[model samples]
Target: MSDKYAVPNKLPAKQVNVMTHRKRRLREEESHHRVKRLNRSFKLRSKKRDYKKPEFFITQYLKAERDSKRMRRVIMKNNFLKGVDDEEPKLLVVMHHRAHRVASKECTLIMNSMGLNRLHNTVLLKNTTESLALLKMIEPYVVYGYPTIQTVRDLIFKHGFLRIKGKRTAINSNKLIEEHLGEHGCICIEDIVHDLFTVSDNFKNVRSLLLPFSLKAPRDGWSKKIGVSYSRGGEYGNRKHEINALIERCL
Candidate 1:
């Protein structure tokens, strides 16, 4: 009865070999499945990483903005060159009417670059393509127009200040003018007014000497709504020759 319940001492060699081969095959299959699972997990992790990247539409918008700006610059250059070849450049009186609190950082930087730091501050700029382009960019915040000689002269004599040694100094004497702009042939206030009015070759040098003119609000207050175009019955944007009248009122 004991012998009937007992197992054989050893199995046949072929049987043992077959069992060993089967175990090895099972182990290999398990290892292959494990490797496949790990690969699938890695792929899923990569997919998640890609999803965490910046949105496609946001990148597209940024790319479009960049392209538009580049195209705008090219257009501005062409227009400026054409104007230069056709006729004399005009002087544009650009006035900043808006406050900085509501302005974008880019607009503020453009204003700062043009020396329009304060409200109602006006700068005399050449009607070059670059200037016109910048004006177009900040049109909603500022007003600009062609100024008559009389208007330019009055603005310089009445409200013009000089940026000297990093300080705002009043234009008092030709001697002071000579001290700063002598090399540029602008020895007197008249020279500056002439250069500015005519938009001459020395215009840039003369403009560099003068600070933006600070003017009062129009005497009767703004005739039209603020922040609207002149054509739309507002005081902002290009008022053309009508800017002289506005400057007169402010003065």
Candidate 2:
């Protein structure tokens, strides 16, 4: 056969290189799978050890029940004392300070129900026994206290927003207020502040029109970690009347 037309007895250098590359890739893939298999085996062994027994969950449930009862007692006692003195708070300002990552499903539900789904969001709630009970259950995730009249006024004037038709709108004019809340007798911003501060019958209607107040971090920063209770020098839990001071800094 003519040399030009004859097939080569040995493969070209390029073909040899391509074959070697394919073999190298196969080896690498094999090694990767081996490593993954080893890792998966180790993980399985660790998971076996980490698995919690049913008894462990039972103990956890019992502990939670005990804590719930204890908290209920404390709330009832405080409410009783306040009632005796006619000093029970009419309204409470609750601020959500922590993130949902650390909150349980129950706490998240309560916070959402109270319009406190975001960090640093504040809402005004009537200080009913049921409300207090729910707050105590999620005490670790919120800061609450009785807001003064001035604080109520400032919050409504400064941070107050309305969720009109699912849109967040500022309280810029009395007309907007009258449009949404005139029937409830809250015809203006001042009416909202007055109703909220006095916990009047129109309070719930006014609150329904307003969105949760989104506040800034305090100018001086939190006194301690956000997870700590206010009584323990942290920002969470009830701050009593001190919430007004916190609100001022945030505003």
Candidate 3:
């Protein structure tokens, strides 16, 4: 938390490098696995720990695949819009998690090239926070971050998920509403999914999480600051750089 991110006051970097840290972690994990396998094969290890396929691990892998499908779907719908042949296509942005500025800008630039506009249509958010993961902050999203139904179940059942930034996020709603809801059973069916189709390229499940989406837009100044004007200066500058780079690459 101490080491904050400052966007270096220049044209923003691209998203291609956002996962560098995560990729390093993955490589480390792979190395560890290889060493473990070698030890088991050679005489260096005494106890032969049999590779038991745990159902929990299986569940997590499935969850990641599911989330990825959902993500791609969200991306296609919001960003690479399907219906319009003539008009500018809307871009869908699937933020797997809290992406850094460079990643966000690169994603926006990519969508624009695919005939979609970042200022409209794209949606970026953490899928697991509120429902899919249904647990705590999901620190594993980076390296230790492993997504699974079992891990989520543990978070909800073991930890009651009472604090803010848990598996899900509650927007600027009344605290009294939360307290009262906590005291009693309630039902809030966010109906937008049914009304409007949302495909998740990551998860592949199109849940109706519309109320928050609708509510969040106006609150996020969507109604007022839309079109090209809504693009923030820093993000826009980065988008410009990314676009030029993309064009140069194509050439």
Of candidates 3 and 2, the better by lDDT: 2
Candidate that beats the other on lDDT, 1 or 2, i.e. the better one:
2
In order, what lDDT does every prediction score? 0.81, 0.82, 0.31
Q: What TM-score against the true fold does each predicted structure earn?
A: 0.65, 0.66, 0.16
Predicted model with the maximum TM-score: 2
Which of the two, 1 or 2, has more TM-score? 2
Prediction-by-prediction clash tally? 0, 0, 33
Rate residue 105 of model 1 by lDDT: 54
Which regions of candidate 2 fall more than 4 Å away from where they truly are?
A: 1-85
Rank all candidate structures by their lDDT, best first, as comma-separated numbers: 2, 1, 3
How big is the positional error of residue 204 in model 2, measured in Å on the Cα after superposition?
1.2
Give model 2's TM-score versus the native structure: 0.66
Q: What TM-score does candidate 1 get on C-alpha atoms?
A: 0.65
What is the lDDT for 85 in model 2?
26
Clashes of 3: 33
User: What's model 3's lDDT at 190?
Assistant: 21
Residue pairs of candidate 1 with colliding backbone atoms: none
Candidate 2: give the clashing pairs. none
Per-residue CA lDDT of candidate 3, range 78-178, in tens? 43232333332122222112222212233445433322332222222232223222111111121112223332222222222122333344333435233
How should the candidates be ordered by TM-score, best one leading?
A: 2, 1, 3
